[model samples]
Target: ALHLEMTGFLVVKPEGYVEEAAAGEEGTVYAEADYKTQVATNVQTQEVIDSVVVYITGRNYQDFPEVVALVEDATDQLTFAEDAKAKAEAAAGTGDWQNATLWAGQWWQYQVKAADIGLRAKTFLDEHGAVETAQ
Candidate 1:
């Protein structure tokens, strides 16, 4: 039996600068920040989905010397699903589900695992100077 659901994912790129009008200044100074947004959805239903955005801005950007390092760290921590998939495939090699439930659980575990990973990654990023400006 196949349990089907609509699914999709998105990655948002950050805008480089923000514009503001100073009280007495003639022009705007560079805000100096980066941002990204991500979203996921069920393809069949087309319903609104929960999502997260990671951003680095303001004085925080100045404090963090390696912004990309933070991003890479976050990405590195999110391989749980990939690992789960590999384990599932290996277990299915014997053509059995009884002993494979642990590995086969990957399908159900994906979303939860991914979400947890995202949250943790976001936390790590924030601690290192990445800000969550919006969802």
Candidate 2:
């Protein structure tokens, strides 16, 4: 697994995960988390024949609520897709590999979505606000 940390952000991903970046404003940072792993396999082959992958990206610039709102919207969509996948698996029932894979694959995509990268950015800014306020 890979781990990353900054003043107010943290990310962890298993080995082999990929990261992509695009040009943006000076202070803006972007990171994409790949959550693709073996989701199902062929019973007879006993080999990992099927896998799924999707990218969840988080972007931020300093500590702005507008930026947070954009990230939140993307995260919301990612969560919706994840929940639908779970429900599909449950409804597919056991020993039904074909149906399970089919239903789950319906929600899996190689697309990138917005995600939350920091849970403590606001706190960090609050703690450091003294410098700004004092100036």
Clashes of each: 4, 0
Superposed Cα RMSD, model 1: 26.5
- lDDT (tens digit, per residue) of candidate 2 on 3-77: 345443666666998878877766422121111222432121122111111111122223566435644654565
List candidate 1 segments past 4 Å from native: 1-74, 106-114, 120-135
RMSD of each: 26.5, 22.3
Candidate 1, residue 113: the lDDT equals 47
For 88-124, candidate 1 gives per-residue lDDT tens digits of: 5565566443334454344335545444544554455
The whole-model lDDT of each prediction reads 0.41, 0.39
The true-versus-predicted C-alpha distance at residue 125 of model 2, in Å, is: 15
Model 2 poorest ten-residue lDDT run: 48-57
Taking all chains together, the TM-score of candidate 2 against the true structure is 0.33
